[model samples]
Target: MAPQDEPATTDEGFVPLFDGSTLAGWHAAPRTFGSVWPGGPDLAGRADLAQADADARAYPARWEVVDGAIEGFQDPDHPGFGGYLVSDRTFGDFELRLEMRPDWPADTGVMLRRRRDTWHGLQVLVDHRKSGSIGGFFGNGLANFHAVPYVLDVSTGADGTPDGLVLEDPATTLEPMTPDKPARLVRRGDPEAFLAAWRFGDWNRLRVRCVGAKPRATTWVNDVLVAEIDLATLEAPNYDADAVAAFLGRSGHLALEVHDNDPRFGEARWARGARCRWRALEIKELSPGD
Candidate 1:
């Protein structure tokens, strides 16, 4: 049964994903963004994820409603781990719009097409720090940006241990599709426009469009096109072309995320004590023509 404030599974046209009073249709994400990858814990080694899942369920304490907005406040004492408020239902082709404000050094973003088991999906970056670029596409569990524009070829020594490698090496074993012009992970049409459009220290509007079987996602920040991503071309280690294609076709949950605290990436210096807020969150489903 649906809660009183929960949105219905089927709505007429556009619908508010959040009810503003409670997290009726949302749950805490099973894991924190960017914590279990790269230099973090091994996902398979974590035997206590269930407890973390339970902690995620008790999200009211971590994420609360304040003045009609959902504010994510991080505990200064518990700095390293982060959490996500994820939608229970999954979505496919649609347009999602929301307004966000990052205080000081808060690192955050919106997640779409996120898989439950793999925890991999397309993340629309909302980083507001001077070194960060908002509206880039983050391929969860991938190399943090667009996949390599070309494939690599390895050369095997006499011992056959594969000693050398090169981009598009003629002796490559796997089939490589090196496009004449490979797609970029994030495409900001006009950097100047993006810079001018940003409303620093205030609410900034963001819109993301995901459509088609190949899922080309384009993001707009304050009415400026910040990025255009071909979801299929997004890459991470061990994710081959087939894996990427399958992920592109499947529907997955939508989420909002906070980057885990890490001193190496300057999170400890900047992200600690930071908070991010979201409001006016909504989504509109799309049809073939529309």
Candidate 2:
């Protein structure tokens, strides 16, 4: 039932990352608004995502330890481009599990191997819009912005109406594993079944397992292994060519994100009305294939 990489510290199926008590093994590193890491772009700030902010003395701009959980809030007063609620360290070949409830019109994700100033390999998007978004890249390389493990034939676009169709495309055909044309299912389609695939305004379970050197990964939504990606090209030795020229480049950093520019999502989005915090988080053990 766990996303198998390394077994949880306990054996009750999966160990608790958030023991529902306190921040035991977690660290605090706030990525406050306006405080963009010394990275190149001004893609900085999480102010738009949050309504009010905590005391600047107690929490950093990017994160907080509230009610025994790690949470993010962008300054509603400064609704600019939001940045990542980054993890303090980098991880390799690990398993991760977390739950989040997104606000309406959000473009957010969990980024892995996120170098503060460079690129990352794995990114799983908790997209409210019914876009088949999965393992993509950001920063250094434009790896697979829409490279999904599976491309569904769902009706896409502002004018696309459901036409009752389903199809899959090899990752190579489309650049982002995203569809080439507007994808949609017909109106006579099973509403309950389609909705069941995703939950709106509710806490959804997300799990990821990364292994192997180049680090391929498997993603599970509510225990179903819905996607997989081969990270062979991750070893391309092209990230920060100058940085690599100094040393044998081999690894990357990891972090989480909240995307800006609230695009008009389609009806496929279940949580079209949700707003507020995404809670109950944990990251322990690396489940390889369970």
Candidate 3:
């Protein structure tokens, strides 16, 4: 692995996505779009295209380069508005590596093979909030299938400030399995190993590898294998591999999300003034031979 401040060498076959000083190759996704639920409204249809484009141009989230890192937060002026910073290039099979440190209460993620026109894809969960789970798989538009290893809660210090995180049993934390909410295909990784590898309040390295049209995606947190999902064959309720492949295709842009602070939650989904910082973003496009 290369240092966080420098790009990987050619020998490593990884090219830098972030230039370390600017958002040169990135653009914002649409703002005001609702979370990509199973039966969510079609915000990208021709009927709404004009409005969606305008929202994208306005880009409600604040994304900027700070101290050699990409900092993303909900724009103060546009409270409750959040969006994604998407890469200009699209990739089919690739391994993405980046370092991220998100503040508590933020529901962020790395959207893989995300549609250029909307927030539809496979999401690697970075939900840094109450009862949230990291390194899980969330189907943004593929029937909302969630495959999480485990959920977690934050530990507070004496001053009532978040001090650390405590892993919780998925059996207790997750909602009961149902037709709309399925977890039977979840690949629950080692919780103790993940906890040991996780660095609280510090930047943690995340690596994701996606391959094939009906992709097999895997995630690692701080070098600890967190979760894996073979989308093509996983027997999860409401998931259709052929339909998903048709919807997303073999290639799409990668995106970094800054989630909305929904009013329904009452409490802010993202902490006020808090930003998630990302650095050392690089990707290695995979070939069939390799």
Candidate 4:
């Protein structure tokens, strides 16, 4: 059976995705808003992030309550491209439906199976300009250009795992789709098809569903289906592939992100059990299948 909080697939049916005006089931991570709050393990002073001096604000990554919603914006200068506003808890095997409208020229997506600011599942591309952008993050494993979009190339070493049983070369592991590739089934290997489909300058509606670790993601631009992907077993060398697989077999979080160097706007709303909006939020709980 699916977990109680799994998205869309409810045992009893009709679980609130968000409250009208608050982040109820979610918790803010340490460096949520700006950097961290002034007296916590999270960023309090200034998050030493790349382009920290850009649109980046004070610590805790200042999230504001605007027009009755919890909103986050991209810093025009930061280049991390994976800045996260993660949920403290981990989740799996559920459906998530949310409304998102990007107000900038940045790439966007959310994560599942994230731990301590690390992501282990997939990143459904909001912008269509990445290789395998429709594929999973494949952390320490594989990546589509959109997975880590600062550059079209990936860089890694064999030292990815503590035991070194696996070889991780971000350059090779993370494949990038370039502008030369076209969008045909045969062209899927060329990489450009991944980016050619990317659309910019618009509001996107996203729906993500995870059945254990196998995930299905789809994106819509102004209500038009722009992207879709279905993933089988998500492989990684950083964790015991089997154990990592099991951990994601139950529950996790609906962690949101604002990748570093991004210029987009993001907010999440649900009518679940809570009645609050998320600013710099964090949520923690044992991932499902624990």
Task: Point out where model 3 deviates above 4 Å.
Answer: 1-10, 31-59, 169-186
Candidate 1 steric clashes: 0
lDDT tens digits by residue: candidate 4, 1-290: 12355544244333554444655555444223321111212322355643444333333232344654566543323323234555544555555555554432334456665554434445544432222233223221123213222223222258742221121234652334443222211112222433343333322334444453544444432333434443443222222435444534445456655444323222211111112122222222223342
Residue-wise C-alpha lDDT for candidate 2, range 98-199, written one tens digit per residue: 776554434556766555543333466555434434222222232222334333333344676442313334542222443411121011123234335545
Clashes of 2: 31
- Reference-based lDDT, each prediction: 0.64, 0.44, 0.78, 0.37
- Give residue 245's lDDT in candidate 3 (0 to 100): 89
Please give, for residues 1-290, the per-residue lDDT of candidate 1 as tens digits.
25555444435456788777877778775443333333444544466555454443343225777887888765456554566778888888898888898775666778887766445677877655433447766667643444222333334579875343233443532333433213565564565566567666688999999876557788888888767777566454543545555644556778887666453565632366778999988898887446
| Regions more than 4 Å wrong, model 2 | 1-8, 12-61, 65-68, 130-144, 149-195, 233-252, 262-280, 284-290
Model 1 vs. true fold: TM: 0.72
- Predictions ranked by TM-score, top down? 3, 1, 2, 4
TM-score of each: 0.72, 0.56, 0.85, 0.48
Candidate number of the best TM-score = 3
Runs of candidate 4 exceeding 4 Å displacement = 1-12, 30-60, 74-83, 88-90, 128-202, 213-243, 247-249, 262-290
User: lDDT at 151 for candidate 4?
Assistant: 27
Lowest summed lDDT window (length 10), candidate 1: 173-182
Report the C-alpha displacement of residue 55, candidate 4, in angstroms. 14
Model 1 lDDT, residue 67, Cα: 85
